[model samples]
Structures are given as C-alpha cells and as structure tokens.
Target: MTEPLFKQIAALIEDSIVDGTLGIDQRAPSTNELATFHRINPATARKGIALLIKNGVLYKRRGIGMFVSAQASAIIQERRVAAFAATYVAPLIDESILLGFSRTDIHALLDQVAESRGLYE
Candidate 1:
C-alpha cells in the first residue's frame, strides 16, 4: 500500500534532517515551495509540515519561517528506529516462529545476514 501524500512529505523532511541536508535552526522549505516542488496542494504540504511541528521536529520562528529543531535529527532517528522494529523486526520474529525457528536460530540468522551486508561490525 502507498503512504499518504502528507506522510510522504513528512518522511521527505525527516530524511533531510537525518541525512544532514537540513541542520538545526535552518529554515525548512516553505509551504509554497514544497507544494511547487512536489506538485502537491499547498494545504497538503502544510499538513505535512504541521506534523513535524506537532512532533517537535520543527518550530515556527514567528515571522521568519519554520526551522529545524535543535534535536530534530536525533528525534527522527529514534522514531525511525522504533518504527523499524514495529514494521519489520516484529513481523520477522513472528514469521520465524511460524517456521519453527528458535530464538537462537533467528539471532544467528540475523547475524549472518548482517555480516553478509557488512552491517555486523
């Protein structure tokens, strides 16, 4: 299933923050800019920005613009980690159990997979 447009916009901003494309105190793209760039409605783009503000990933600067919060990247990273566990890890565990894999077996398999991907360092 596809994610909603607003959520996709939100994820785009989150990725920018996490990847250092956006820095703390830096202004985010305005609603107009976002709408233009993504070919989305201004309202839809605003909804996405609103999500970030509500989550403390962004803050308004009165008359200036929305800026990345000082801790935005860290917060985004934490949220993504939790989301990954829920979205992928839990399902993997459930499927492993259904396949008669023991906890140890799952752990070893995960280790092997990580090693193959050079992610086990």
Candidate 2:
C-alpha cells in the first residue's frame, strides 16, 4: 500500500494488459466488479478506472463498459521502460561513473551478470 489503493488498482489492470492477460478491445471488469472482488468502495474503483481513461489505457464503450485500448500494451510498455530507466539505470550509471567504471566496464559487468543468471535467451 505504498501507493494509494486506486493507483494499485490501476497498476493491477495495467499489469494484466501488458502481460497479454487482457487483450486489446477486451472489456475490463466493471467498477462494481473490481470493487466487489477487492472489497473496496466502488468510488475508489471508479477513480482507478478514471485514471486509466485519462491515460488512454482504457476507453469507454458508451453504454457498454470500459475496454482495453488498442495501444494499451504499448503505452504501458513505453511508460514502464522510461520509469525503469529513470529509477534504476540512471542511478546505476551515475554511480558506476563516479566509481571510475567506464561504459565498457558497465556493459561487461551487465553481460556477465546476465549470462550467469541465465537472463539472456
């Protein structure tokens, strides 16, 4: 609960969209459905849905319900990549440079770790 419940709700839905659990144009669970499932207030769930709508991750279908946007996965991926770079890569690079590590050193270190961890397919 480091973030607000509504934000957590939005992230949960975004995770599903990004992981292909929820495909493009798929109807997202309704506000009531989420609220019921999570035992939260409907208003809180609506706030989460509203945040997604504002971000274009989800779109309303008039009288129907909210659906995944065609670019939902791409949008989530782009945003997440930028966030990951800012939060992790940037700091790591700055620290590595301060510690006298060159760009090549960083690349070698990363590759070594990736190889050892079976991260490279």
Candidate 3:
C-alpha cells in the first residue's frame, strides 16, 4: 500500500528542499497553491505543511505563508535516513537472516553490491 496523501505531500516538499528547488529562507507555496497543484484538499495540504512546521522544517510568518527553515535541508536529510533504515535496511536484514545469512554475510553482500554499482572506491 502507498503512503497517506498527507505523508506523500510532505515528502514532496521535503524532496524539493533536498533537491534545492526550494531554498532555505524562501517562502513556501501556500496551502491553496499546493492543494491546486496536487489536486488535493486544502486541509490535506495544510496538514502536510503543518507537519513540516511542527518538525522545524518550516516556519510561518505572521499574516504570511510558510517559509523554509534554515535547518530544513538538515531536517529533511535526517528524516530521509530514518526512512531509509526503516523502509530498506530493516527489511533487508530481516530477509537476509531468514535466508540463513549471518551479519558478516550481509555486510559482504552489501559491499559486493555497492562495488558492483561503483559506489565503493
């Protein structure tokens, strides 16, 4: 199953931040703008934006829309690491163990894969 729409919306904003499409200290798109762009409800867009604000990835200006926080990129990177570990590493470890692979075996397999992908120097 896919993530909830709000989470997807939040991820989209975080992705923009990570990719430098939305720079820190820049005004974020309004809730209505996001709603229109994604064809989602205003409440859904608001919830997504609110999540970022609550997590210190964004800040709201009085009478103005939200702005990207100075720490937005770092916050998004931290979230991405946690998401990666949960979504990929945990499952991979579990499946590897189920397949009778030891910790060292898993490490070696991952190293081999990384080398094959030219990720290792």
Candidate 4:
C-alpha cells in the first residue's frame, strides 16, 4: 500500500537516521531541503519533522539543526510495535472469538504462520 506524502517522508527520514544515513549528532536536512526533495511545502516538511520531534524521534540542536535522538529509533520501534499489537492482535483475537474460533484455533493459525514464515524450528 502506498503511504501519504508526509508519512512517507517521515518514514524515510527516520529510516535514514536509524541506518546511519543521518548519524547521531548529525543534522537533518532543513525544511527547504525536505520540501524540494519531496516536492512539498516547507510547512508540510516542518510539520512532519515536528511530529517526529513530538514523538521524541528527533531533537533540535538550537542554533545548529535537528539531530537524531540517541533513543529515537528505539522509541519509534517501540511505538510501532505497540501500535501493531493494538491494530492487529486485539481486534483479531476479539473477532476470532466472536466468530467462534477458540484459543486452540488461534494457536494453530499462529503455528501455521510461524511454520510458513520459517519462524518455527
């Protein structure tokens, strides 16, 4: 599925930081660079970066520029993992029971997934 422009941009920048394209203590691109690269408004770019900052994924360096937080990638991963559990697991479990699938059925499906994905040993 395609992501929205701002979200795509945010993910790209975040991934860059995590993968060392943007290092610790290194500054992120200015809003203008982001705007030009992504063909978006500077305001939009700023808002996207602001979202990361709000989530503790980035931090300002005042007179310098934005830097990846030491814990930024870990924080982002944790948030995403929690969101995934909420979005996928809780509802799936509720629906499975409502549709008469028991815990055994769920465990069986999980085992199938694990085996199919080579996660089972």
lDDT of 2 by residue, 26-87 (tens): 99999999999999999999999999999999999999999999989888899999999999
For every model shown, what is its TM-score relative to the native structure?
0.90, 0.92, 0.84, 0.78
lDDT of 1 by residue, 23-101 (tens): 9999999999999999999999999999999999999999998999998988888999999999999999899989999
By summed lDDT, which 10 consecutive residues of candidate 2 come out lowest?
1-10
Evaluated against the true structure, the overall lDDT of model 4 is 0.85
lDDT digits (tens) for residues 30-51 of candidate 3:
9999999999999999999999
lDDT of each: 0.94, 0.96, 0.92, 0.85
Q: By TM-score, who's the top model here?
A: 2
> What lDDT, from 0 to 1, does candidate 2 have?
0.96
| Residue 54, model 1: Cα distance from true site in angstroms | 0.5
lDDT of 3: 0.92
lDDT of 4 by residue, 16-94 (tens): 9778798766788888899998789988888888888888888998888788888887887887789899999999999
In candidate 4 the C-alpha lDDT for residue 51 amounts to 83
lDDT of 3 at 12: 90
Superposed on all Cα atoms, the candidates' RMSDs to the truth, in angstroms, are 1.6, 1.4, 2.1, 2.7
Task: Please identify model 4 stretches exceeding 4 Å from their true place.
Answer: 1-4, 18-23, 117-121
Number of clashing pairs, model 2? 0
Ranking according to TM-score, highest score first: 2, 1, 3, 4
